[model samples]
Target: MSASAPTSFDKILIANRGEIACRVIRTARDLGYRTVAVFSDADRDALHVQLADEAVCIGEATASQSYLNMTAILDAARRTGANAVHPGYGFMSENAEFARACQAAGIVFIGPPVDAIHLMGSKRLSKIAMQDAGVPCIPGYEGEEQSDEQLLKEAKRIGLPLMIKASAGGGGRGMRVVTDASDIPEQLRSARSEAKNAFGSDELILERAVMRPRHVEIQVFGDTHGNVIHLGERDCSVQRRHQKVVEEAPSPAVDDALRARMGEAAVQAAKACDYVGAGTVEFLLDDKGDFFFLEMNTRLQVEHPVTELITGLDLVAWQIRVARGETLPLTQDQVQLNGHAMEVRLYAEDPAAGFMPQTGPVLAWQPASGEGVRIDHGLRAGYRVGSHYDPMLAKIIAWGDTREDARRRLIRAVEDTHLFGVTDNRRFLAAILRHPVFAEGAATTAFIGADFADDAGMHALAPQSHHWAIAAVLLSSQSPVTTRHWRNSGPHTQRLVLLQGDTRQTVSLAVSATAGPGVLDVTVGDQQHTVRLGASNQCIDNQSIEVDGVIRQPAWHRDGTQLWLDDAGQVFSISDVTHAPPATTAGAGTGQIRAPMDGAVLDVRCAEGDQVSKGQVMVLLEAMKIEHSLTSDVDGIVASVTVRNGDQVKGKQILLSITPDAPEA
Candidate 1:
């Protein structure tokens, strides 16, 4: 175990999935190490599986049955003859028991020491440890008392506008912001339930929510040789639901003095637990320029690419080198920060609809490519996105000499990136990048909620006459025909009802003889336009259409009468209600609760014949690792419950039915 000894492992098993696994594989391969990938049934054909030197099927689609199955992961490593295990980010990455298991199995875990993981894994314990280490921490309650009365008492003592967080939770799960004292009880219940389901722990922690604080985290690394260094800091202030959306290096608010202080505090926090390998110390900086320790993430962060871009270093590579007993390559003074770097997390979720996750096949994916642009993803055409995991599809990073330059480049890159079949947040991220508040570098944690609360990004773009005309022409014909049917016969007109959010547009395509063989006279409301159809390159659900004289290659995915078009960065769902069936009125007349998205029913709150009030929780559905409660729209007696707990449901599927209240019997 000498510090200078050569790394022992020839093959490293990545016990995780998605972009992070692929990320680690690339770096390990560059270091001349063969990589093994463990995959769940859902990820059988994932890009990471194909890129690895060896692949193993661990278990089922659910994370607990697969990626989180420590025993199965270790067995896969043993079967593949892998001498080391790299827990890439999410699954079991910071689990202390997983690290200990790796050590007992005689495999190198490419992360921090087991003690460090244990200490930072619990929010309550980590806050106490940070205070003891002389790190400034937020005022809150971190006691052993678990009673509801005790928690209520502490919340009152801490004052209102506090945060209730799960001791063992990350990624914004098991966390709630309580503004009013009356809402604390309900928030506490929800947080505990989500925590137990997500992390197998129900421990709670309370902290005073800092108003409009900037989230800044210092990336620190350590080695077995007792060397540690901080690689500057990243500002992750642009967040939604307490999770980071956009991250950038060299925070706009931090100067040399503040950075030095934060970096020193981060390094001290790491040393307090004898931490080793890559870890991040998060802090919330207030308006007064004071920073408080939040927590520590003992794994490669999702926003690590921004740090790498600014520092000219591969953090994953450093992790492996450190795990192999290598000392720090550069001292704190030697490490230099370069140009500004920014990253946006591209997710398959609809920002217009409460950021609900969407799942489907990736019909077409064209990532942006140019100078200063980098796409880190595990996505490919034909890849199926399931609701069994996170909704993030990729991370796009851009670097420039200035923050504005980096921001502009990232915006342009996001505009060029196109995806189909699944609804995504590409336009949403672009909007955030171009917002004046963000452009001025003054975005805090309240950026999303305050500035773009209504999701103006998706609705800001009004469909032009040309856009409607293009849609009409594409929908009028399925193939190229030699004879002009409308010319030979009478003028035939087709009507299309296109829906975008709540707005609906009726487009009529009138095929006439005077117009060419493939020409159509389109009319949308009072706007009239002439559109000519040209050669189309159709690939499954995707198509490149030439409308009028302009050629736009829009990624298209059609399901029955509904078509999704990804043109540039804008996404539109066009429904051709030409041959649609009559709607059923029975469920509409009565009260019916339908599933919001494709997910598994986690709990059923009511049974048949049960009386329920309006806005009462009827069914709880779990999708994309988040729980959504389906509430009753009208107070009525339950007539039938179609779905039970553990039942998988599709979007708009009826989960239960309620009969209108009866008059006096």
Candidate 2:
């Protein structure tokens, strides 16, 4: 029996987690709908749970045990008497089985139908449909054979540099680009395995990797009444590892004619799938604006805010409306393009450290705000950056009448953001905006990899600017400023060494007092730098500067390299020579106990001349937000410890050494 669609549901349950959950709940409540939320064991006290009108704990911390458990989510919805279920993008948003289950149980799934999802979610079937719909698609094999040898043959026919992709997944996972024949079979096998693990589908597809094509997508919406329309386009060419880090609407390159053609194709694709609710049709466009269909996201995208800003439409509210069996409220002719929009994904990763994930408590949290700036963040003032889920912490979006305005706004907003406790990529993002290539809008998927090979662009300034900036922030934020009392009233130059992990560099700066009491104008090598003092006057004053505009907390102290930053639930240290004392090889010890990796000491195990055995857990060193037990190298007594638990240790910091003493009996 087809249940009668209510004009509006009294309540809805969010079958997802994180920022999107909080985002949807806010809109739902504003629409006068009570919201129910679910959480895993680790997220019991998560911000989204607190924001919801009702909350329930589902399972453990792992994604499979909690968020992806469709039955558990549907069961929670049923138990809570929620008439509608909204899957926020990731976990089960595109799962056909989950939609079928919801329909079987009489709950409204706020997305496209199960048939639509099933038909389009399969990349193989979608390719056929798109080809049938007159959409310009790439020349590749969408054949039947699934054998490794068969796929290899097809790859040879399609030529080199082809993409081996999972037939049922997106998001750059379950995909591989093989450049040589020797790498094909292994990559094919890996792709299939990852596809199976991620989407429960080992079947794969092959496509010719387009050269320098821009990734532009159209946000499309459709209802059961067969009406579908597109809302402009998003430029997602600036990516890393095939995943988008920055997105913008009103693409700088796409002209009116190109948009209209792409929009028409998107609508036809949605109609072919009988798509319902909000979705985005992804496409790859060549330099001349000729395009090919990539995939149709059956759920709302994370960068939907850009579309909202450009089109002045509330996609979430529209999603709720369409789920209630409403027809398209407007036509294609009704859409209007007003402004430029951009969104930057802030992740808990150290870009300088090969983008490794970091976890820790949030010491300071100040998101950007003002005209045309918005922050969709799940974290609060004291939230811990976790490692179990995607590393994205918040999305900072900006909107303006012009693209230049949006860029300037983003740069200013990112600079104003003050984050602590956990390491964030704020400086890196800011640097991208100020970069010459990005400023000219000349970036592609290879832009980051090419421009940042040496990271010279992101870390553009010299050591003098950085040191003075840190000192300026510290002096301004901490101690009271007094008059510059130098007897000669000349430049007071000081030489200092800066250390990051195991690397060290020496630099000298001539510090001259500026016009302001807490201001300093410093000169390094041949360039002059200016710095404003911070609030604190103690250790680094009390303020920190944004590193390269990707807001990362600075870790420098007056003593040894004993800097601390937490990631997820663990603490990580930033080691340097300033924190590492001289090796204590004075006592009975062997060769030496060298620091394994660049990290900070969480604790020291044995003291000077303590009897120790082989394979013993001697010390605890933390790096990249995870702990490693620094065990003894040989069975003997530890001679002496040169570093403390809170001290930062470099790659070769000799903590202690077991001397070659009397033979162990």
Candidate 3:
């Protein structure tokens, strides 16, 4: 056992931004240590910056120039007289070189040893090490020879339905599941490309995809005194696009005996690397009670709140203590897992649009709060959510005496959370929590794709008549009371054409003054409804209204001809185009291929005059840390390409144009 003398640091610097930085600052302040925060230009007014004792602007908005800028971060700590730095997950959190640099600069690094991070950071090397340590691992190829031909040959030998994973980094980036042999080549290329962009490494490892296995991970902690212990397991099988959406502690599938086995294996994995501070060892637990090592995250995880709630422990505090050369507060047997806890990640994204990330001002922010509900976020009214960072905005956690109790509380918490002015997945999260499979704790990694893939709520729904009615009332109310009187006509009729996506709804509205002040008698189709409006609160962009005797207080915002409304968790966007002119086009058959979201152009596959088939990918864009492929909608010849590789673009910006082929020649 290696021992070290206890050290002290008066102030600590956080080398990241957003909720995680705020999380660390809270604990550090509670421990009576002064805290400093660093931010990019985009996050100058971020919640974390406001909460810190002092903040320093690191660099520009892009991550490469800011959060991931190791030299700038270290210099900030030096300039601030911070004796220690806490890298709160992501953006060099697990980087071995950063840890070494911190140590060399005489700044205490509050994480595992540099050697441990260097060894386990690579999936290929970690698997080999785990195998040598007698830890169970899935059978796959982790060879040094990373040729396309070699990978193809190995794929056939490994059989169908295998996974290709980037050797470095996590977060579901650079991962592909190949169920058919024909997809191996393209999937390989995509995975390698993403891996290179995300982790600076294109090397990969292959694993036989475990069928319907639960993604269970054991949370482990270590100290410089050679003590290591586990905090039990969290079931993270519920996922979308290989990214974890929901996480819970004390996995329903892990009984006492199974927990003992998995826990011991996780401890051994940590001890093998001489780990210290906090880490998690993930595994794929099959129905037969067999578990295989997946990977080890060498820093605090995004879902650490679940473990903290159940154990009644402050993990960040433990990290600080261990960094000061203090032994772990509790041993393996002394650590008690008390209650069940569940957590859901809230993202600023549109589930109806293939989970594309959204960015805009936060018109309103009301997070849920209760005895057992906790929210960790960095959001505020009027805060601008940019496209430069990850879309995840907050985490909601709930704890109860039992799993069902925790699940119920979490569901309610999700429903109660309110956010406006941007598209998000709150509705989708509530649906997942209410799912029968998830409620019964039978969810696997295939849960999202199998059950909710085609859920109607996951797609754009046509606007209902009531939606247009509400929009008409709001639009009419924008004018003076005198003009809203309809010129004292016996019956004033108005027409509205509201556009949502590519679908439009035309409604004929006839208003009568007899409905009284703040009310109107609006006719839609053959039905007449009484609509009453309350005073608008522009501060939060919300108002109370009664439609057909049903009272609802929905938050709404208006920008020119567009209106955004949020009722409960559902959002409706209505654009008044009643007097708008016909659409114009430069090519044939919806020929303009536009970017799906704000992103950097990774590749442009077609040039001018190139023949392309329907559904053939013409542009590759990277946004919110995910790659999106923009495809041609009709068979045509490309007329022009407006964007070049490495060009940053906004949402709906045209990338190219195609001229459709003549029919029936």
Best by lDDT: 3
TM-score, candidate number 1: 0.91
Residue 376 miss distance in model 2 (angstroms):
0.9
In the range 1-665, model 2's lDDT, one tens digit per residue, is: 13335545678999988899999999999999999999998688788999999998878766778988887888888788998899989888988999999889888899888988888888888898899988888889887788888988899999877888899888777888888878988899889888897678899999998877788999999877778899989999888888798899988878899889888988888887778889888899887778888888899999999999988889999999888978777889999989899888988877766676666666556676799999998887567665557778889999988988999898777765556667777777877777777777777677787875565434423233454334333322222322243222665544444443444544443334445344455443454555543343223222344433334344433323334332211223333343357645442335367665556687888888888887777788765434567677667777777888767666556777775456759
Better of 2 and 3 by TM-score: 3
lDDT of 3 at 53: 95
lDDT assessment of candidate 3: 0.87
lDDT of each: 0.86, 0.74, 0.87
Model 2 regions more than 4 Å off: 1-8, 455-665
TM-score of each: 0.91, 0.76, 0.91
For model 3, the stretches where C-alpha displacement exceeds 4 angstroms are: 143-161, 179-197, 481-497, 506-516, 541-544, 559-561, 578-588, 608-616, 634-640, 659-665
lDDT of 3 by residue, 1-665 (tens): 67889988979999988889999999999999999999999898899999999999999888999999999999999999999999998888999999999999999999999999999899999999999999999999998999999999998899878999999878788998889988999999999998998788999999899988999999999999999999999999998877899999999999999999999999999999999999999999999999999999999999999999999999999999999999999989998998899999999998887788998888778888897999999888778888889999999999999999999999888877888778888888888988888899899998998976776657765656676678777765663432245544566666777787777766655554666545677666666778877776344454778899898776677766777776666677778887789877643357799877788898999899999999999999988877789889889899989999999998888999998888875
